[model samples]
Target chain A: MASKKDPRTPAQIKLAKQLGAAIAEARKKAGLSQDELAYRCGLHRAYMGFVEQGRYSITVATLVQVCSELDAKPSEILDEIGH
Target chain B: MASKKDPRTPAQIKLAKQLGAAIAEARKKAGLSQDELAYRCGLHRAYMGFVEQGRYSITVATLVQVCSELDAKPSEILDEIGH
Candidate 1:
């Protein structure tokens, strides 16, 4: 179990938070509803919501699909998230 | 648009693919149904499936949530995925 106090490090955790928020923002910018994004990416609406909330770690495949749906790339997403 | 001829570098893509698979494997190992994991991590279940398939790029916040659900750290997840 990760320690509640900075479970990991602040830098990584901060990076993750920003990244998650960026993805959510990007998804919205793309005019994608959670379900729409999910459908396009072959993801579940619930999972898409989870991702938006930054409550789960994601796989590369998921990232790719999300990017594809957004018409973006990993680098662009990463840049948005400041990572 | 990313070129189909190695949209990204093969190494990065490969690393992403492996990382995606590792996350899926870890999610399963944690005895977490995608929905259950999503619930625990405050995620959407559909995104979980997308992640499992390595179809998308994930945010750090999402990564943290997923890792928390799996009782793992980012390093561990990265290590598992060979990134």
Candidate 2:
């Protein structure tokens, strides 16, 4: 394995879950299946699931792609958590 | 690497750079050196540099931490990109 960073801290994971919840809400509103959204974003469906579960630290670019697909703004999602 | 994902696409990189630029601008306005910001975020100076250069896909938690240290809202930074 290559060099890896430390695991996400609990606080970080809590924030990530908030983000994931926002994304999930947006995706559901957009009526796209998680797999469909992942396909559109050129990501694996499993990866998308992990993102939704707050199990992964999604990149900014990926967030854009996901938000774009859902017609949701990243700011809107960030706003959900008062970020 | 273990089950690595693909490298960022050109479009993704462009978007990343834009995000990075906004963050850099905010960091500068906050009067914090890159190294100082990195220290506060518990990240390596080199990683922070890459983030500023749009070479890294920063996680949401890290972004929040960085923005918190800058006293800038993540919403404000995403607003810079119309995200």
Candidate 3:
């Protein structure tokens, strides 16, 4: 498991947080709770919570799963981060 | 280290390949070789090649590092995949 305090630069951390917020916003827009979304993505509810909190370094595969479940394009979520 | 054959869905794999191609294209547009870009991002050259080849799952932190070095936004790369 990756540590909560992974070795990311400040800019990277900022981007991760922004990305997390975007994901959370999208999930809300799609009218899915964290648990429901996690179930749809086949991810653990706790893991999904961590992701939304920006507490871990998220993998591209996981991102795709989450986005697919939310009926969102990965680019759309990323676009909200402005980077 | 993640395996080359990670258990990603077909859609995820396709998106990964597209993202990799976009990264490679952006790197070229910035006139940076894999070696140069990897050095800038503090990643191994072979690892960078794997990323470009979409042979492994990439982390958001790594994406940020690469995009920063390439003068790109994460959304731009994901956008090229149209998702």
Candidate 4:
């Protein structure tokens, strides 16, 4: 239910995009599709897509759940991204 | 405005605590008190304490903002914590 017009700053938006890409990369490496990952994380498929597109703000809990499903550490993906 | 009874999973809760500690450490290293850091991040001081206590769920934007103020990268703090 997040709108594109949400008030995230430019830096935050950049971080989101970078983080999203990293998650998507991890999911791919784990041989999982967006829908599959979403199902595993108990997140909606649409929400997963939105997350990958950086159109949504991800909470810490959601990030952990996604990483657990992908056999990835949140830091693995996060560290790969530039601050 | 978050409660200890938040519906986060145990894993999420652990991650939150680890993350909170890392942030608190960063703030200390920056020589900033919780109130000072919260003021810099435009967050309420009480909310900052909750975040430090892992009693609140942090969004990506908030994490980035906190990191920016602390001269810490999200990944730096996240990677230092055990998954």
Clash number for each model: 28, 0, 0, 0
Specify the CAPRI tier of model 2. medium
Q: After superposing candidate 4, which stretches have Cα over 4 Å from the reference?
A: A1-4, B1-4
Residue B27, candidate 2: Cα error in Å is 1.1
State the DockQ, from 0 to 1, for candidate 1: 0.14
State the weakest 10-residue window (summed lDDT) of model 2 chain B: B1-10
Highest TM-score scorer: 2
**TM-scores for every candidate against the unseen true structure:** 0.46, 0.88, 0.86, 0.88
How would the docking of model 1 be graded? incorrect
Q: After superposition, how far is residue A50 of candidate 2 from its true place, in Å?
A: 1.4
Residue-level lDDT tens digits of model 1 in A1-83:
87456454565556656656877888888887788888987678898787777656665556655777787775556644543
lDDT by residue for model 2 (B44-81), tens? 99999999999888877788889999999988788788
**Which ten contiguous residues of candidate 2 chain A have the minimum total lDDT?**
A2-11
In order of TM-score, best first, we have: 2, 4, 3, 1
Q: What are the runs in model 1 whose C-alpha is more than 4 Å off? A: A1-12, B1-83
Residue-level lDDT of model 3, residues B1-83, one tens digit each, is 86456676787778678778889999999999999999998889999998899877798778867888888988767766776
Q: What residue pairs clash in candidate 4, if any at all?
A: none
**Once model 4 is optimally superposed onto the true structure by TM-score, how far is the C-alpha of residue B71 displaced, in angstroms?**
2.0
Q: Ranking under lDDT, best-scoring first?
A: 2, 4, 3, 1
Per-residue lDDT over A16-66 for candidate 3, one digit per residue giving the tens place of the 0 to 100 score: 777788899999999999999989888899988988888777887788788
| Model 4 quality (TM-score) | 0.88
Reference contacts preserved by each model: 0.27, 0.87, 0.84, 0.73
Candidate 3 regions with alpha-carbon error over 4 angstroms = A1-6, B1-5
